[model samples]
Target: MKNDERPLIACPQCDLLMREIPLPSKGAACCCRCGATLYRNLPDSLNRSLAFSISSAILFIIVNSFPLLGINLQGNANAVTLLQAVQSLWDQGMHLVSSLTFITAIFVPALEMGLMLYLLVPIRIGLVPPGVSPIMRLLQIIKPWGMVEVFMLGILVSLVKLVQDFRIIPGVALWSFVGLTVMLAAVASSFNPRDIWAHLDKDNDGKID
Candidate 1:
């Protein structure tokens, strides 16, 4: 590519437009003005991220389906699923807390995992799916709202207190929640969104825009 014909890349941090160039394997492009990492060129980023995303989705289903914690108070035994706990909060009239918890704990993470899969799978196979730009925007918008770690901390704290009065039986879903958190972390580290944009420039015939 000629100097002027090379693609333009505006720095995400300082908005300084620079000419794009080929990166070495596992290299990153940095902003000239602010030194922010513009993007990375990681080998097998798509495959690694896809694997973690798939694991996260499975763990997500398991977390919601089974009992998160089994409670036995004074001889009465009860099981509480994730949704059940959220419902209990709602029944207790903590409506705002319940809604926020639901969004952060359940809704946003699910959306993140689903969007990752939708973007990664097609790009892995060398096909660009529809709605790439909007999907990428949505991922960025929801990334910070996924408060799984915070929610997990709250669960652990509550369990510590509950163990004094109730027999806290660790359930499969509890383990799965921990696993989901780990898997999501793995997905985030492995996945690079710029890969999708790189693919977006290519047509089916492998033409670059």
Candidate 2:
């Protein structure tokens, strides 16, 4: 009932409520009921998250700039970049599919990585940037919208089917897209919002506000 009391944390998987306990540096706390990891106190989490964000941003640029796949059919060569694929769908009147593909494959992932860098880079230096809370909330909302891995699976299926009819050549952008997906996932796992909250609370002298 006191503001100074340790906060209560509910296990996300099981909804079991328990008081939060202090964790050692580079330690993890888990839910007792479901044995799911509740939070981690990873050493240098901010720096690691910043690194991942930067890596993902570079990979994202590569994914959009270069061709993803090349095909040769009857001596005719064609290549498709990520943007070209979306544009082709739109040109064929599949506007909805084109928009969805662009959002999930390009927009959401880029936004997530950008927000991560914006938040973590300042936090790493013991300074909280303006609109930190709102930006963090936006990041959470966009997190689930990033479906790069799912898009990669669809690409793999298309590649398999296309290979049967034409010469399929995977491009540099395709590999970069794979790397971007992995980097994004790593950044998500490494960056715990609770850690950010803790840092903010400390900077504000025991309260986020």
Candidate 3:
């Protein structure tokens, strides 16, 4: 298509109108006004996103399935899982904190990763499923709410304080949560909405190919 007829994308930072053009596989488009990232043209965005999101999901399961920490105090042994930790907080009357912890660390991340996989898996097979627009919007809205790394940091800090009093043994879930935090970050970086739209564009008009 001609330059003027090419798709125009406004800068998300400053609303400057610019034409969106084909980019190299490793190339990125930046908003000229504020230098914010517009989009990136990564090779095989679908496959990469699918792989990372799936791995993150698995790690997330491991995080909740096993014990987060094993502790011994005065000859008593105890272990806690992710949900148990939240429950402990709630039992201590920190209801709001516990609720926030459950929502951000578990529910939001799971929902985000689930939505990502829902989109990626089908698009990998060349099918853009119904409700793509709403799912995409939901992902955007909840992406900020999935603060796994923040929760991880809080966990580590609390563990440090507890170690002075109790014999704390790191559990399988602790390492798994660490990995999940990294993998979730990878999933977010690999997933680009523009790439999904490219698929929709191709399917919308077979003549474009």
Question: Which of the numbered candidates is closest to the native, going by highest TM-score?
Answer: 3
lDDT of 3 by residue, 1-209 (tens): 89999888998889999998888888999987799888888898788889999998898898889977564545677787768767766776768766876877777778888888888888888876778888888887876765656765575466447444323347678788888888877877787788788788878763221
Candidate 1 residue runs with Cα over 4 Å from true position: 71-75, 125-128, 146-168, 205-209
| Candidate 1 lDDT over residue span 79-125, tens digit each | 87767766766776768766766777777788788888888888777
| Runs off by more than 4 Å, candidate 2 | 1-5, 13-16, 33-36, 71-76, 155-168, 206-209
What are the clash counts of all predictions, listed in order? 0, 0, 0
- Against the unseen true structure, what C-alpha lDDT does each candidate score? 0.75, 0.75, 0.77
Largest lDDT belongs to which candidate?
A: 3
RMSD of 2: 3.8
Candidate 1, run of 10 with poorest lDDT: 159-168
Better of 1 and 3 by lDDT: 3
